[model samples]
Target: MAQTEQRAAPAAPAGHSVTAVAARMRELRASWPPADGVAVFNNVYLTVTEEVGRNIGRRRFPDRRGAATLDAVFAERYLAAVDAVAAGRRPPACWRPLFQYRHHPGVRPLQFALAGINAHIGHDLALAVTDACRLLDCEPAALEGDFHRVGDILERLEERIREELMPGPDLLEIVDPLTHLIGSWSLERAREAAWSAARILWGLRELPGLAEEFRDGMDASAGLVGRYLLTPLR
Candidate 1:
């Protein structure tokens, strides 16, 4: 997507509201250049948050509150990272690559988008699930339905992103390095891993030290994958 003329940053969201999150995404999209890696991811994520909001409004989820809470909490993780970067602080390890490479001209838009997805789904989503569980006073199982519903939306959107952002056949041959690089990551597998991590994190909730260590490991591992995903293929 082409970037629009720069505009003022939107107001920070007052709370965990999906509408507010979507607005913030729009603001970021308007403020950043189209070629920026973070902007690329933000555009994709904006579409997702909008779709999720619509689903919530249409009563797609059996538990509306749970779905909304989960969506907002999940989005907050990404937005907070954006805030941290703007404040000259380091974001979580999983998000470091995307922010670090946001302006690299060699990274394709699709690569940027996928790297962001990997960081969010691979690391942030797990933590978000546990965060939501704590806020809602429930176990991970209680939010399983909502989690899958959100994942389903993400899966469909990911397919669309690939279809839209993939380079043309003439530009991308069967043995193209870019093709192989992009193919190395899978959203399905990431989502599965995130779900497992969420369960484990939830189980270790009582053991704060162990949970923190596990969370740190998850963050670092996801960051590693994200760095690879953003590998310059041009």
Candidate 2:
């Protein structure tokens, strides 16, 4: 009799239309419904991560332009979401064309930085898992085995992230082989992760254009998705 192997179930699909998702994000800002903020911020992570898998699903992986567009949307939106988390205010500034999605003020660039960092997290997760799957996809049957190692690596990442430890090299085993990929670290141990996390958020201030773009884009993109989280000042 042959032994069986176990694998991670494919990640779930993104739930909303891109524009609908974007629109709902705006509604979160516009209404300042705390629940909505959490929902959209969660969406930020879900959409970006799944988008990566979906890219693989398409098998054509978007060209640089589409990728950039997606990146811009992610960066812009995540920053707004983070600022809302920080300021104890709602997130705002969403955009589309031919209309102002949101026009709130007082929260700006931090929002954008927040958006970018969050996007980075989501992208990295997708890159890791998708590549992990791709790697499993490539191995010869004899060499092929359980995705348990993959699951273990991912679970370790989640735990270390919770504990704020610099995960050992095992995650590299999972994500490193992808064409071009990188992993994130807590920068400090568990006791320091929360502090480092704040610093990490603060450090984002140093990134080129993060401060300014977040400020400007928060309001500009309001019509986009973030506006839903705040009350639009008329």
The prediction achieving the highest lDDT against the true structure is 1
Instruction: State the lDDT at 227 in candidate 1.
Output: 95
- What candidate 2 gets wrong by more than 4 Å, as runs, is 1-36, 62-69, 87-92, 95-234
User: Could you tell me the lDDT of residue 225 within candidate 2?
Assistant: 30
Please, what are the lDDT tens digits per residue for candidate 1 over residues 1-234?
112212222222246678788899999999999989999999999999988887777667788777888888899999999999999999999999999999988888999999999999999999989888887788999999999999999999999999899877743676887788888899999999999999999989889999999999999999999999999876
TM-score of each: 0.92, 0.24
Residue 152 accuracy (lDDT) in model 2: 32
The runs of at least 3 residues in candidate 1 whose Cα sits more than 4 Å from the true structure, single-residue gaps closed, are: 1-14
